[model samples]
Target: MTLDPLPLAQALIRCRSVTPADDGALAVLEAALAPLGFACHRLRFGAVENLFAIRGQGAPHLMFAGHTDVVPAGDAGWSVDPFGGEVRDGRLMGRGATDMKGGVAAWVAAVATVLDRRPGLPGMLSLLITGDEEGPAVDGTVKVLGWLAAQDLVPDCCVVGEPTSKVALGDTIKVGRRGSLNAAITVHGTQGHSAYPQRADNPVHRLVRALAALTAEPLDQGTAFFEPSTLQVTSVDVGNPATNVIPPSATARLNIRFNDRHTEASLTALLRDVLAREAPRHTLEVSCSGESFLTRPGPFVAALERAVQAECGLAPKLDTGGGTSDARFIARHCPVAELGAVGATMHQVDESTPVAELRALARLYARVIEEVQG
Candidate 1:
């Protein structure tokens, strides 16, 4: 029997596996893949759950990676249960229908189709499913990758099933992702009556000057495959309600989305230099999530282009303009690209995917598998 992605997609949607929670999502996957002769291994890192399943062996291994976790369904105004997995008005409705439990279901069904046809295809097929992609990401793909490397199970090429399409299923494939960094700076000053001009130094003034230095100019102009780096001040707080007194300190938070022209170290150094000059007495805390990366266009990318054109009749545009995904983690080990369903409803209320689009994505992934392992 040919595997249909619809039922599996619905089954996955029914699991309330919101970030850091398995909620039996991995069990569902294990049941599906074990029937197809996959060797499934459940890896638990801290409170996070991960799965690694492989079928077949030898050279030219192709791995499909995704996360089962979904962001929380916020305040409820949904027309259906967020975990109901209801099929209504031609859409599969749920929390992860698009980003990206639906994508995972499609790839699994595609693998089933390939196996049924060849049964013993000349190469290997594997999956790296994580439960922490929507969380801190410290315990997910990063840790599994180390295990894969130690076991010598790295693939020749990998495809991360993140929702990459903007307007249509095959319209865009993410070739790279910008790096993300967050910084919090606190400026110290003396607290005193506001009327005393020289008796108190206003930390808020210092904080504003420091931020001005950081945002004074663009990080850089656009690169060949990336847009210019951007920094946004998210918050500034003094928390003082007294109008007559100057606050002792001020804090500001900033987030940066950067491209290949910069690294975390380079950006941090720049930030320190600015703070030192503009706000002489301050403490800064920095957090770097994923560094910028790219997979240069090559045979693997060409094959995906051909597959997408043949399946969807559209030339997929290679892009590097999105928030980071597990592709960043995979990029460190192998050439990886991200292509999946339209992301119109990824993290919003009534997060959903059209039934027709879900099935079409299944066909698209099947074509990718064929082209890569042919």
Candidate 2:
């Protein structure tokens, strides 16, 4: 029998699997997969829970990657309980209804749907699921990938069940994602009386000048498969409450969502060079989420496009204009792409997906499974 995705989505949603907290979410999914002949591996790294399950072995190994973790529900004005998994007026409502959980359920149902029609799977099928995608990501997919490397179990390709669709299911598939770099710039200066203009070397003024120089130019015009790089200042801090005192130190945090034109090293050098000219005395600290990567339009991408056209009757647009995802990590190991439900409500209040849309997504994923193997 083909598994209905609705009930499965609800069951997963009801677990309250917020970031870094399993809350039986992995158990619920592992229990479901074990009955279908999957050898489940529950790997815990630090405080994060991850699951990797495989049903077959050898060539043409295909992996479905996702996370069961959902972001916090935020405030208290929901029409329904954030974790209730209630369906009202033909919509399934919950914290993870669209951001994920729903997509995860749909993919599992797709596996069942495909298994029902054929005597056996055409190739090895596996799932790399983590409960840390929505958190620090320190011990999530990054860790499981290390384990997979140790066992030499890397797949041929992967499809991440992130909510990539924009207006409808299967309307868009991300072929690549921009690189992300976070930089913290702190400028130290001399504090003095505000009345004496020459007595103070104000750090805030120096910080603003450095930031102005940084934002003065476009990172690039953009690339064919990617968009122009963007730098956004997330926070600026002086922490001084007095209006008459010149602050001695100022700090600012900014993020750059850059295309393949730059890597973490190159971008750091660019920032440091600019700061040297604009604020020579500033100290800089930087971290990287992941470097930009693209899976060129080849067999892997063609498979997903064909699947979307077959199920949704429209040619899906191949895009790369989104924030970072776990696909960045997978790209190092195998070709990867993303497709899932419409993401209009992801990470917002009263997040939800229509009942019919959820079912249709399962059908789409089932087709993707078949199209990729051939």
| lDDT assessment of candidate 1 | 0.93
lDDT of 2 by residue, 1-374 (tens): 57999988999899888998999999989878887778999999999999999987667888999999999998887899999999999999999999899999999999888888864667788999999999888899999999999988999999999999999889999989999999999999889888985988998988999889889899999999988999999999999998899988999999999998999999999999988887888899999999999999998899999999999999999999878899999999999999999999999999999999999999999998898765
Listed in order, each prediction's TM-score against the native is 0.96, 0.95
Q: Candidate 1 has what TM-score? A: 0.96
C-alpha local distance difference test of each model: 0.93, 0.92
- Clash count list over all predictions: 0, 0
lDDT of 1 by residue, 1-374 (tens): 37889899889888899989989999999999999889999999999999999988787799999999999999878989999899999999999999889999999999888777878687899999999999999999999999999999999999999989999889999899999999999999989999995999999999999899888899999799999999999999999999999999999999999999999999999999998888888999999999999999998898899889999999999999988898898999999999999999989999999999999998899899989998
Candidate 2, run of 10 with poorest lDDT:
114-123
Q: Whose lDDT is greatest here?
A: 1
